[model samples]
Target chain A: MSLDIDAVKNIAHLARIDVSEKDLETYTKDLSNILDMVDQMNAVDVTGVEPLSNALDATQRLRADVVTETNKREALQANAPATEDGVFLVPRVIE
Target chain B: MYSNWETVIGLEIHAQLSTNSKLFSGSSIAYGAEPNTQANEVDLALPGTLPVLNKEVMNLAARLGIALNATINKRSVFERKNYFYPDLPKGYQTSQLELPIVEHGELFISVNGEEKRIGVTRAHLEEDAGKSIHGAAEGCTGIDLNRAGTPLLEIVSEPELSSAAEAVAYMKKLHSLVQYIGICDGNMQEGSFRCDANVSVRPKGQEELGTRAEIKNINSFRFVEKAINYEIERQIDLIEDGGEVVQETRLYDAEKNETRSMRSKEEANDYRYFPCPDLLPVVIDDSFIDAVRGDMPELPDAKKARFVSDFGLSDEDAAQLTNSRPMADYFEAVVADGVEAKMAANWCNGELSAWLNKEEKDVAESPVSAAMLAGMCKRIADNTISNKIAKEVFEGMWNGEGDADAVIDAKGLKQITDTGAIEAMIDEIIANNAGQVEQYRAGKEKVFGFFVGQVMKATQGKANPAQVNQILKQKLAG
Candidate 1:
């Protein structure tokens, strides 16, 4: 179940990370160690053991079906790396 | 080459819970604030700040499970999903790993008139990370902390759907259920509900499932259906050409209406998921579950059925009424004020909704109140006002002029329903339109309509339609 070194390199590349050569070897070893732990999980007899999904058994609570947020000011602003006066800010390229 | 192929589709939907606070902090869960304004020390994942589970978030997740007809897990624990992202202030995202809030549920979706039950894998609670803004000023990236730490319920569905239509149906059903349960607002435009699908294609009747790829963060039903269809075709082509589908996470490029590879899919262990040490296990008793269920409102399907049986509404009308709770309440309120169910439904779905949409308002903010619309309907029912006059009154009310009765009175829109008055007008029309009267008597019986119109015009358009028709017909015959 160990992830090959090349597969680890492919994963790092796909994730858009610049893993240096030395780090790639380290990651390959670390990831293999992790997958070995998962392999240990395959030995357990879970043929009929129900998979656990939730820790709490309670029902989901409902809120008053009202428009809590009429203004989307903060939600819209949260993603903008730059903003001013309730508007998204960007660099003036032409100026 | 007509060969057999089967497509398997599963969904992971992320819905923002309609809670007022963050899942792990007391900061307001308000959307659209200045960057980092809503963030607290905990939301920022500052040192020494331990995560606290919001009781309301857990309850909301449980309610979604119930609405999906899933089994509520008595014990669900939160685990830290280790990852690195600027948006995720917490270097590790605290999410459900071992136990989720819901399990063993089924979503019954009606696809092309055939009902199919999709398995509910799990629904769990987690906090939304902050957003990253790339390609900002001078090719630099910017990070916004405003949406950081919002509560979201990740609902995962099994790969039960086979076609694009079924996928859309399943998405819509989940959207409607969350809205009905009052857990999530189900606003797709506001990013309240988002869907991602894992799709794979295999040869027909193959017992082994194909390697599925996950499409991430598609915000609309149209995008989901398109993404699934595109992925299915892409996978089929790859298989036909002897290429194997890779297990990876793909991003849906909405602008291009296509999916692009984002990353190779990370296995559960890749994030180093372990039980969060800072947070305690979430505990729930039977009383909590019962209380949450007790607070549950009538779901959409049941409410739609009620609208049909009680209000004598058409299938379309019932569907529209139960689409949103506020709209349904407004419709019922008008009916409660003694308006005919059909008339109330018409006004709500037509004129009222039109006005609301035009003003970007909801039914709760409708200018024409239920009682006012009911009064207008009553006037027409009692023959005190013509349908045309009622429309005029409705317009006046929409302008915030007055109530229906007051508007009608101010506009002098009362109908002339008296038979004698109508008969007098009809006599005048007969005398004035002598040529038409002669033609009516000479076997052209359609001239009776002309006489009725003349009577209406002579009465200044106040003549009761039934009375005017009856008097004109009787006098024309004589």
Candidate 2:
């Protein structure tokens, strides 16, 4: 239920976030407090109560299978940092 | 490849649902569209956008589960599979993890005439990430998000497959079943249907499973078999060399027909799956399952059984006819179009199949229609053309000459059934082949075929074979 400095660093790396060495201890303490609060909430006993996925007590709304969207590549790609031939460009990722 | 070793393989097959729109968004899911043209805002995972379930996707998934006799989870939850990839714009993939939509299904695969039951662990609904086109740009990867949010049914098989051939048989059976039920298009080259194999090997009598290496994204059936074979051999070699098999992901290179480690995604196991808060738990009822079941076409097994019982076809012929929906329908249509059951089955499974294989075409793509074939078979039934001449007529029909009657008339292929004319021709053939006829009359019974062949040659293979046989026997006795 607690986060250590190395665990925090690993999480930061997985999320692709940069954390200065000085801030690691502080981030660890903050994340540990958040986990503690989550652990405290988990202690509540409600065996018969249903877990709610959304705030509204409703099942997922079903949509008819139909395409309503048209080509708007220009507008959608307007905010992209880099694009080429109507595709978003990023650093080369090889598998 | 070792006799003392046993290979255990499990398959994860992803079948893209044939829908007009993306799984959760209203974007089009058509293949080969211009890059990003169909990437709607919801598929891009824009802030404040929520996903809604496509009713058709659920119906198809449920249809598959019903066909497989799987338990449909009434309340299935969607979870987010967290990962980092250029093609995944949401930073996580919306997939079913803990509460998959279907579970505990089983399918049978036949290898070497022995049926093996393969258990389906579960099937889940998931959204596909976009395409990352490598080498599309200089020093960069180009991402096309049109495929993002596309619906996929990830069917996971239990690790019971013992060899590459068995794995392939299982895959083919599943492939035909999905296409039979109209759930997937099953186009491997286009990525509509893809498979991954988890392979491991152990000593023959050992019970505990060895570490498995997952070969990923094999798109073709051939590639699947080759990849599994290569991986098995690799594992056996590694073990024999006193090395250990690492449980990691590997990629199959079709060019080299080999598999290599893809170490980049080895940590892909740590997906940290959690409930996707945006999509609510989908609840279902018996009525939903019933509706899906009603719309499902007859499965391959049921159709094969019907072919056997109703048409009196042999087990092998029935199986061949029902290998695909279109082929089964084609066979039935031939029978319904006035050809007898056994004749229809013969032409369908024999000559028609040979022509289709030679032309590298599906039964659906055959130039000769079912009705056309039925018409041709009727000629043989009525003694208008012998089966030998019918092949020539069939070839003519396949060449687009016309229907059976037209081809028969054009090629002068009508069977010679007149008793007097055949007798005269037999007399002439006996006159020509005097030595052979003497040998036949002197108790050389096999020379009778020579006389029949000569008579047939004179008639240009148009003589009815039964009449030829009877007359040759009668005339040779004298």
Candidate 3:
């Protein structure tokens, strides 16, 4: 499937990205090329092939029915952009 | 708008599975954690970082699938959904695109006593992205990675909902089932569970679907219902005005009660969906499925049945009690502590529930113990404590002072069951309310109630009601 110029523009705008006219023409051609490769995938018969949802085919593992975590406050709050004691700090809004 | 335009609605709900860690990382999924503090290098997508799937999340997804009567696929794979956003620390999101863990399940949800079979298209496991903090600065946007990489089970449904009520019903049904399974905590206020709706309208008997818009990130159920209704009307008006309904993702302004277009609808939101090179395909074997099935607690349906048959509760009462696992568990524990099932269910659904709500406390944090509640009921049954005293004791128990026995004793709330004591009160009442006594003797039998009220007031509401009646009747007849 070849990419359409309108399709490229729509996708970029939906993604909240500004694409220049020169870049748009280039992407139009590049996306068409990529879609053509994807079109080849459509040719292969996948009637029986299952679509995968995860990497492992193993059965789901079970955790012991117990709480493994309790406290890690300092560690958890270590990366805040701003901190007051143990809590995160955001910009004050009200007067 | 003609009457024949059938509304086709379906929902894709993202429920954050109640796992301790992220789906593919070791970061804590604890709510209210400091921003970016719980995140590790993997969550931050630092160089050479890799994702390792949390096994408990898989079990949770399967447990939900089993409850929904879905087919658990033995094999599933993760793919990269490529998108660039500040909240998405990873350049692309790892999601289940092809083989979802559960598929082709059906849920029978009842809406106002009308039952409908809604199909579960698929339920897949994925990781949540961090939240973007917008509208804060004049031109700056910040990202909070506290919720980054939390495990999410994306449950998608078929377009079987024909009305907004059905859509909301489906959501409610899913919400209850997930909570019942103990997979998703179902805390809508805390953003643990959320819903996105895909809605479209078409001419009657049209072979192809009409243009549909995806309404994203509606956390509350009422908003979901209203947003769908508003979007449907918007589409109809657009079509009537000879305007094409643009396919796009939109956000609902709940305050405004309207949906505004956020972005134009795309044929696909291309994350350039590709197989993630980092992770391997997940293989689910029978043993894993069996273990998950074994780990399954008594679900809502089974609990409801037991409540009806064993506890002799009505179907509606049973349904209400078992709608939440914690409430149902509390009811059973109260019964186990020797309260009559009917009485146990009553207090649990009534005063106990009211106390929890009034104090904004969870049942797990309830100060009243099952044994204490049962003992309180026993006091009421044994004529040891008056109903009024029982309520007083209940409050004491709610405050963690003590259970029925201790509270009743400490407050001297025991019933005045002593015949001598009650007889004395009755004599005083008969002497004082001479007119009422005369009226009773003159065949105004209803005046007996007035005499009883006087006796109760004389005793400070502590006299046993049955004993008061017996003594009053004997004296009045004499």
User: B404, model 2: CA deviation in Å?
Assistant: 1.7
The residue-level lDDT of candidate 2 at A29 comes to 93
Give the alpha carbon lDDT tens digit for every residue of A2-95 in model 2.
Answer: 9888889888877789999999988999999999999999999989998776677888889999999999999989999999989999999875
Q: Which ten residues in a row have the lowest lDDT in candidate 1 chain A?
A: A60-69
DockQ each candidate and list the results.
0.10, 0.82, 0.15
The C-alpha lDDT values of all candidates are: 0.79, 0.91, 0.81
Q: Which regions of candidate 2 are displaced past 4 Å?
A: none
Rank by lDDT (best first): 2, 3, 1
Of candidates 2 and 1, the better by DockQ: 2
lDDT of 2 at B99: 88
TM-score of chain B of 2: 0.97
Clashes of 1: 27
TM-score winner, 1 or 2: 2
Candidate of highest TM-score = 2
lDDT pick, better of 1 and 3: 3
Over B111-182, each residue of candidate 3 has an lDDT whose tens digit, in order, gives 889888999999998888886665444444555676878888999999889888999989987888898888
